[model samples]
Target: MTNRPRIALVTGATQGLGLALVEGLASRLSPADTVYLTGRDAGRVARAVAGLPATSAQVRGELLDVADPDAATRLARLVEERHGGVDIVFGNAVMRIGPDDDPRALMDAYTQVNNFGTTRLMRAFTPLLRDGGRFLVVASSLGTLSHLAPVLHDRFDGLSSLDEVDKQVAAWRDAVLDGSAAASAWPGFINIPSKIAQVAAVRALASQRRDDDLRRGILLAAVCPGMINTPTSALWWDVSTAASPAEAAVPLLDLALDPVDPGHYGQLVRFGRALPWKP
Candidate 1:
């Protein structure tokens, strides 16, 4: 790592996986560093920061709603002004809805926060990342290309820019909204496509920024923490045997703080292994 003071940020950090990530960063980073934990609610953000264990690293909170198109850019500007640049950023803010929920009513909001909102965060903070920085998105295992239709493989695999990814995701969203999605052509869970879009954005950006990332020692990857027993997981699976957020956080922390790995850049990773885009 560079000698410059490290500054990190985690969005949706009021509780569960996001909060656990904030705690882990505090424990791992030196006292000289700072970690910003953000949530939509001011009270929750304040409480989350206040509840963290005493650690060498400084912890603070900020109010952020990833769904707000401008919130991320505003925060990015603030961080830039205060610290010059950011060292680590985790795109963890998300929305979860059950299969029974009304897709017509919730689909737009869900896609907005989980897909477009995340892409916005990446765009906003990536420019301010310092040398040797790491940009990681807490995506899901459902994001694997194997979950999508075979016909869609080339489109996702060939995505070379964020705009292309956005267009693809928008096409998917438009199809769902228009009731034109062929049955079984996509995963039933609405979350899958959103996750896929988020991971694809990582790949596209990684490709776009390859030279700069290599020159500056920056690493970018989307990680699947897997079946964590958070409220989000409870919506779709039995939590009896699921890993707690803290346990799931172990590998994620390693990915965030470990030495930069070129092989993992632009890949969707699970347990430190890169998943094949097309399975």
Candidate 2:
């Protein structure tokens, strides 16, 4: 919102929603702004940066593997040194690799990068974010509660606690190992939305702890781009039936650029609509 032009750091920016977000922000910049596109792959990050046009003198690439604590530390230090401060931080990396068909393995990688990686990044980068800026956590709607679940199920469970949800995940693993899709449903902890919300909570809290005045100025929220047809969907939200990356990027951009918050920080939003993201 400042005329000085904002500087943003977007993770997982090499493709899909992350890729589209950088493009959207780049197009909106007035030459005074800048964006740092980061990904685990050096070549991909470079290619993504090079493909953008009219980007502020600021759009560039940095290699960051969120799953690795050391890499995250390096990127955080580098950004703080280079930019002095970061105006926006977009958490959008997700792990979707699966084959040779190991269900537990797939879930392990997914949880590691999408959940733990985001948490680790928040811990390291919160200091770099200027007070009253933005931190958008990108995730999905699956984090909601389930009707069949108990009263405590999550937004994904329709009702549940983290413990119960974790148990459900273990159950699913058992079923998979036994070649039975008939296993009881997974506890909602494995739900993507809940995990994303958990990570974004840290961002919001970290910002608040840094500056008491940040209550109304900073916007830290979990945003679900909503079934974007990216290859990472594992064919669940098929590319054909969902919004394109560009289309899904719009709401997140709104949350990022909105200078004033109508609500408090740590709100989880989706598709321009604000919904409760099970805390």
Candidate 3:
């Protein structure tokens, strides 16, 4: 590893879980470490960075929209130039749920941001993620196998490659557009399916990295922080029983900071505990 400080990046960090994760990470940063807080809006990124508590490690803000491949590439280049490489990447950026009346539009929006956007980031940043690094995808419990149709669940559970997962997501998108998603027993909501694809992609990446002849030693994981009461979530859920963003971020922080355990690779973590993988 280079003598430069270890680096961490969190996307969509203006508010809610992303912001909370940034705060949790700030407290744990070593003097040599630096954290980058990124979002689509420059103004929001600045405000979020300014509000963070003082830390030993430097905290900086950058503008990033995960949906843009050029933006992902630019961020990767910037990190490589400044820090040599990143030690941790928190993929927290997500799209808002659109109106259900337009199923096609809704599916397209979620797929772009939640699925394809994630693929872009992973592809761009994998080269820049130092050996023995961590890539944590912020997923949700709604993506669990229990929520999918049996056929879809089997396909996801048996995923062997990222390409296969990508194909599945594409198929789902096509199904939605053709109005055959319900016939396939797929849920109407876009969030759950999008997250399901995200988790599967994470699993595929972890498996690929581990089996590669040139191992990167990157630990990949998908985490569900539960129903946190964030501004985005507040619109749909009652905040009464929902955990605060800070509270929900605890488990994510633990996973990011902790040593890479091979057993946890490719796992879906809920509140810091790894759930059993279905064969």
Question: Which is better, 2 or 3, measured by lDDT?
Answer: 3
**Ranking of candidates on lDDT, top first:** 1, 3, 2
Model 1: lDDT equals: 0.87
Candidates, ranked, TM-score: 1, 3, 2
Per-residue lDDT of model 2, residues 1-279, tens digit only: 456667888899998888889988887766778888999999999998888776544688989988785877788888778777778889888776433445544665655577667767766776676756777777665544322344334422321233333344444445544655334543433454335334334433544453443643766666767777766564454468778889989878888887645453555567666666443
RMSD of each: 1.4, 4.9, 2.5
Candidates in order, TM-scores: namely 0.96, 0.78, 0.90
Q: RMSD to the native, candidate 2?
A: 4.9
What lDDT is obtained when candidate 3 is compared to the true structure? 0.81
Instruction: Provide the lDDT at 179 for model 3.
Output: 87
Pairs of residues at least 3 apart in sequence or in different chains that clash in candidate 3:
none
RMSD of 3: 2.5
Candidate 3 TM-score, true structure as reference? 0.90
The numbered model that scores best in TM-score is: 1
Q: Quantify all predictions' global Cα lDDT against the true fold.
A: 0.87, 0.66, 0.81
Output the lDDT of residue 65, model 1. 94
